[model samples]
Target: MLRKALLTGCTGFVGHPLLARLSNCDFSVVACSRVAMPALPASATNVLVSGIDGLTDWQVALAGVEVVIHSAARVHVMNDQSSDPLAEFRKVNVEGTLNLARQAAEAGVRRFIFISSIKVNGEGTPLGSPYRADAQPQPADPYGVSKMEAEQGLRALAAETGMEVVIIRPTLVYGPGVKANFLSMMRWLHKGVPLPFGAIHNQRSLVALDNLVDLIVTCIDHPAAANQTFLVSDGEDLSTTELLRRMATALGKPARLLPVPSWLLEAGASILGKKALSQRLCGSLQVDISKTRELLGWTPPLSVDAALRKTAAHFLEHRTH
Candidate 1:
């Protein structure tokens, strides 16, 4: 039987590829977005819902939708200028999400899959002690707090309405068409710019876009995923130095790394008001996906090296033009 799935944020970084993947998987997808989307697959039916908020109506799009993939949320921003960032995030990530899930439950939607963030687990973990799937949530930012609240609301709703909810918290996701820090790193590597991260030994677990999408697809119908939360990654943690070296390898560039002491870097960043940026580059944040694998029997299809190569290739192709 072909499942009818409703996908929110169809134009987002994760949702765009997810829409295509669902369509390719023969799912009759209702691609919901705030604006009209072009180049959708034949299996996808586009529906416009202007902005996700408490009042946004999902009735039309939720019709006959057995599975709902809610990837739309107020994502984290580096320098948020909003006066009340927490309230801003709560309006969309928490209220908007609950509103959609409630309506989906009312519409008889069987399963709802939410794409959350690893920030819900806290900023960083100890070097050897990675966060587990069942770890207590210690959201460090407004975005993370909102997602945590949304998860709590969804759980409560699930118990009340019997609509299954699957929550997936993924670490920094990167692949083709990646932007922000990952793209910047690639750009710096492409230019053979010498970096001073040779001595920074912090492990971070990242998931490839394809791998994350694959996990979401698996959760759509997997019986074990019902009412469960999973943390996802490539399952291979890499230090700052190792990651740059691997990226350099993929880019076919020499890893010109200077062994600058991490203390000096942190001190410099603190003086320059870049402490957060420096922490991100030199902090250890790892998640243990053993539960995700044990329960769903899923493994990342794309290796980190392969994903980096693809990212590098796309960067080179786009940079040249």
Candidate 2:
């Protein structure tokens, strides 16, 4: 008796690895993606990409799909100056999420796995303590707000239709194929670029990409995970200085850091309106994932150090020569 699963966002950073690992499990997976992702090999059941918005009828993909992992989201930096920020976030993060979840529930899908962000807890710098799943959502940006709304909307649909909703909020995920800050940091460390992050003592919780995917798979089968909200991380917190040094070690480069007054740095960034960057580097964002571990007996498979090293190796191998 093979368990059949439907995975959305199969093209995402977490989704690709997840599908690969699931190949060896008892489950046969059918992946759903808005864009064309790399195809799984013949040893695996293979992934199929479908445009959710283009489907005239949901029954094609929804039928007999036991588990639904919703991993797609509109994740972009604030003040990117890129495009219509709100509209772009809403199209995928809100409406896109509901469309799939509704169809899945209607088709008798058992569990809806939502890959939400820690931003739904608090956008930018968290003031003091970590933002737990219990905290009222105070999403500041379009992306964060959209995720929070989607969570509530999914929960409501679950209540109405007796479907199970598993909402997972992972903070600052980093691993192979990682782009943005994590990748930029790797590049800077490899080149020995001086950084101003050493002085900050703020503790931020980060999730290894593999660890997050493991959590997702564990949740898929764990009875306690259904109809629950979990905040997940590496369970180990790191300061900006410590993380930079570790990244440097992974890149086999010296830690390039210059100690500076925190207030002065904030003042300059505020003036230049690089406020978002400043907040990210110095923010005190931490989550206590004991609930996730205690409930499902889950432990991060990859330690922070190993995860960073793997990510760095991947970047260095294919780095622009």
Candidate 3:
């Protein structure tokens, strides 16, 4: 019998690819989306939920689900107008996630895979030092704090219910249909817009969407992955300048980078009230995925160059339409 798997946020960036990957696996997918996703594979049973809050009904989706992949959450929003960001984030990320976990456990779900963020480890790491799976969590923002709290709650619940829990903390994930910072960079490179990241020598680790989805599928049935926390990446780190150059090359455009000082960029961002954005563009945030490899005996199948090229090709092909 094919195991039933419940997936949250199947309409989102990561969720979309994950659902596609699961289609080829030995599991039947129950894709839960907040809105209609008509393009999903016919094999997937689409469940449109009203919300992901504590009061949301998930009985229909959780029926006979052997695995639960929780990917939906209150993500970061620029210019957020919430009166209390932390409380608002907690309501969904922490409360809603635990509610789903509890319901899944009651429904006899065998494994619960929680897709978390690298920010749960901390904002950024120091030079030449990468974050480990066992690092003490130091969530800086409200989103990170909520994820940290959710992880703690899930662990406690696992201890009580004996439901296998596997947590994966991934860095910036980029691929086709990727949005936000990665998309913006791709667009800039495609348009030949000059950027000032040539002086940034900080190393940052990133993961491809395909790579992350592969690991999640592994955890779904791997006995060694139970009750484990993993820091996953592409096993390759790159500097900002190198990343942009490669992206531009993939787009068949010249990398227009100005060799401006990182300090100057920080000062300008401070004046513009974008200190955090500047830090992200210029800071190091590498993760050590040795534990994930050692435990799961898995490696990322896609190389960084291959992922970037794929992303660039997709962007170029779609932009002309």
- Clash count per candidate: 0, 0, 0
- Candidate scoring better on lDDT of 1 and 3: 1
Q: Which consecutive 10 residues in model 2 have the weakest lDDT in total?
A: 47-56
| Clashing residue pairs found in predicted model 2 | none
lDDT by residue (1-321, candidate 3, tens digit) is 777899998888898889988987867899998788778775788899988888887888999898999999999988899899999999899999999999999999999999999989999989889999998999999999999999999999999999999999999999988888888888888788899988899899999988999999999989999999999999999989899998888888999999998899989999999999888888899999999999999999999989988888789878853
Evaluated at residue 11, the lDDT of candidate 1 is: 93
Tens digits of per-residue lDDT, candidate 2, 238-258, equal 988899999899888899799
- Model 1: ten consecutive residues of lowest lDDT: 312-321
TM-score of candidate 3 relative to the true fold: 0.98
Per residue, candidate 1 scores C-alpha lDDT tens digits across 177-236 of: 898988888888888889998999899999999999999999988999999999999989
Quality of model 2 by C-alpha lDDT: 0.82
TM agreement with the true structure for every prediction: 0.98, 0.92, 0.98
- Candidate 3 segments whose C-alpha is farther than 4 A from its true place: none
Tell me how candidate 3 scores on lDDT: 0.91
Q: Which candidate should be chosen as best, given lDDT against the real structure?
A: 1
Error of 2 at 164 (Å): 0.7
